[model samples]
Target: MPDSGEVQAVKASNPGDSQVRVYAVAPRENADPDEIVDGFLEAMTSDDPGFATARKYLTRKAVRAWKPEESISVLTNAPDRDQADRPADESKGRTYPLSGRQIATVDASHAYQPNAPGEYNQSIHVVQQPSADGKSKEWRIDSLPKGLVLGEADFLRNYRSVNKYYFASGENWVVADPVYIRQRQDPVTRMDPVAQTVKALLEGPTGWLDPAVDSRFPSGTQLAPGVTTLVTDDQSTLKVPLNAKADRVSAVACKGMAAQLLFTLGDLTSVRVEQVEIQGSKGDRLCLLGKAQARDEYAPVRNAGHSENPYFVDEHGKLMTLSVGGRQPDRPTEVPGPFGKGVVPLKAVAVDREESHAAGVVQEGRELRVGSITADEELPPAVVTSSGVRPADRLSAPSWDGRGDLWVADRNPVKPRLWMVPGGQGERIEVSTPWLRDGARVESLRVSADGVRIALLVTKDHHTTLQIGRVERTFTDDGQTVAVTDLENAAPRLSSVTSVSWAGPSRLVVVGTEAGGVQQVRYVQTDGSTSATSVLPGLNGVDAVAAPYGEQAPVVADSGNDGIVRLVPGANWQPVVKSGGSPVYPG
Candidate 1:
């Protein structure tokens, strides 16, 4: 409360009195009751910003007045030059503990002075305040653990969370973040205040005491959640999840999905993902097409599949397939296929556009030959509007589950056997399907919505068989799969299946071949119930089969085509794609 004039007067008359004993702040008699001042002193132990220099000097309570430029930072204005040498234990006054308590009324009279706009010091006039009990005083500054320093910055550079400044003799004390900045950037300064201030103080101490110098250090530890990483120029950054336990480590980039790592290990570094399968969010299934040795790391998913219409299945279980390779796929887009007179070719229907399906007709287009219905016309459909299970495109046509979107698979128009569904658009996941490059005949296909699970049926040489596949993926990227089983024991039946539709999940309609002289229609249910009805003389129904193996040859097995012609014998025979008429097994 001393005015500027008084302060000047006191300073002029006491050239030698401008010094005070930092240790004399022990006990004082009740010489002037109303003139007493007292408060607490916080003792900090960590190098955190808030407590950077607080523990170096005899720090005063929050209410204590402080002056950083004093002879001793903890001591205020001055008493007498002689007091500088007094022993700290001289019993100069009564003291009390104020470390973890709230205290008030710590006054500065030659003993303490204001150092800055918002700070305090230890060389303060202390007076004990009444405790809540109102009997004896409890909060006091004398009871603090002795030998602790109340620090002050010699030259604070910036008031950053971590006090980056010079102290003691101009050495540096950069109170840095222990857990946070540890993985961030290396500290530019040290935390030993006295040692930090020595160099600067010895040079020109006034520069160390400039008002513009900041004194705040990094104030926190792993105290809260935040993104504390140093982003690099080469598309690299430390992605640390705040809530993560103290020691978990992980590395990820635009390369692919997030990968797990050694927990006890320190900060994360980039890693190459061996393989990975991605699950689409909600109802969308993921499809990563083509073997992209490095395509999994694409930033926005690279869709390089040619215009062969990919079967698309929306979230609502709708299926659609389109024709792709019209010309070079860039010119006028088209759904291409062989469409000629006297040609009973397999037709492609957009499983997605059920309403627009060409019910019964044969037309020739510049790109694709929109095919016609089987001339039998006697085949009554359960749902005519949904159209037949013909793939309209050449893109890898994976079998449909009626739910998930398109999964990357193999598409051979020359050996079009199985049917497939389409895919929808959105924040989609990608799963690249692994097909055996054995070149074997693929008979059928199935996939999980996650795009990581698959089932394939293939034929080896002349043997009929089934193969299964499962894909495994973790984090944001790694994925791979293995075939589970290959069954070659099943016998050949009549005509190929009219359809392979899944019903009530985990179950499908095993539509048997159509019935003729030797071909017969058959249907098998998951409950072990099967039915067969002969609608034709020798042309029995046929079931489409899927074969697995990239190196194996394509097989066109079919139910026998032993039907009769009432009129013309040559034109009476029906052509069923590449599926030949094999003898229909009665078993």
Candidate 2:
């Protein structure tokens, strides 16, 4: 008989924040049908290596057909098991229905895709079969759903999210591709977390990011045969041994591959990977890269070291800066530009990544002006203008891309369009957005640092939702044609999204509400997944939210009741300015 330890109560924690492991036991001899079903479900949530114990409760045929790794369905809570409507006939079979509210799913690629809460119902059919001794009978599950089913708590406990780095298409900068990996050793591959992350990097980017990024590893490249564990040496260097496919690469490509490993393994806090050394199939060194070198050469947006101070429009409708670091300033200071000098009243403003220039919406949202922040230059002529009569129907807050380009949406319902201003001063180019052709209008917009993704607050059918679209630019003889394509919902759980900003390469901070729920602020991945710790403390009447690229930077927001406030981890929202609005971080 296998040890039948009781299943522990589930405790919610951030993904990758917990290290406790749950062990699963094999089914007891002659277990009844209900017990068999219960044990099977519990086993799926355990750290049982290879799920060998879980398979013991399944019939031989069922074991052959079940593919636990095909996908994972995460429910809001543990599924409820109840007897099916059909009569229980021991010889024929017994059926138990499993029901729950699904919250998200982890596909085969380990990409987490969250959906609005929805009902989930499935069945497990069990039948009595002869024991190994051919003298007794035992209950065994004969049919069940494909893949594994786990509650949100158990899923977070077992698996943790890790960012696998890949280079942006044709760019030296790296982009984060977040995916979940086992917190402990993987049950199926028996590989540790470090090794698992490395393998994931070699497998390439997920489906949603595939078109916008490229992996440095060669095709068919993989860890050497039978190598399932990776660790750092005393110098904090992780040596990755690759198969023959990656044995011969140029110096540049090798560095790119090393940079990917460095960032991916660096996300795992348990491992201190200061350096990464790539090894070829013949055990020869291909390339080596240090953490500092990788950051200087191919750093992600967060590591780019942009200014951390947040900017906001003060009560006087002028751009001001607030320092949220250790020592608070006496009060926010005006920027060194016409918009900051109050030459013209401003509604919204976005500072470039280098903090040298800013773009603002002036003239009651009818005009967008860009000016230098280092000099008190006159606001340039409107790079773009809208004919909409109402301020709400005109221009959105401008956003600066990492490439020094500016993006904004003309909310004029008559001719709604997305526009990009090259160098923040060139002639505005209309970007095509077919999805918005159906009468949807953009309420607000934020461009990612990679210059390839844009987060838009789109309103349609009297409802507003957050959508992420890919910015595809094609060079034509006439010039360059740009289009925003492949839009995906970034926050489906939120019935209405009022504000959004890029918090990280793959994460966005959004202000929205669930169906019939109160307004709230939360962190959402670009892919729409949310972690348990994603929600911040409650704040009332939040109109705009801004998150700096740096992880340690405080999140600033414009609250109607509290004015400008900032939220730091482990602390409540504190007031920054009593009469400020439209807080933003340098894009």
Which prediction has the highest lDDT against the true structure?
2
Q: State model 2's lDDT.
A: 0.88
Residues 389-446 of candidate 1 have per-residue lDDT tens digits of 3443232223322132333232343432232222332222433333333545454445
Q: Per-candidate RMSD vs. true structure? A: 31.8, 4.6
Query: Each candidate's TM vs. the true structure?
Result: 0.22, 0.95
Model 1 RMSD, rounded to 1 decimal: 31.8
Superposing every Cα of model 2 onto the true structure, what RMSD results?
4.6
Model 1 lDDT, residue 449, Cα = 22
Per-residue alpha-carbon lDDT of candidate 2 for residues 322-341, written as tens digits (9 for 90 to 100)? 88865453489998878788
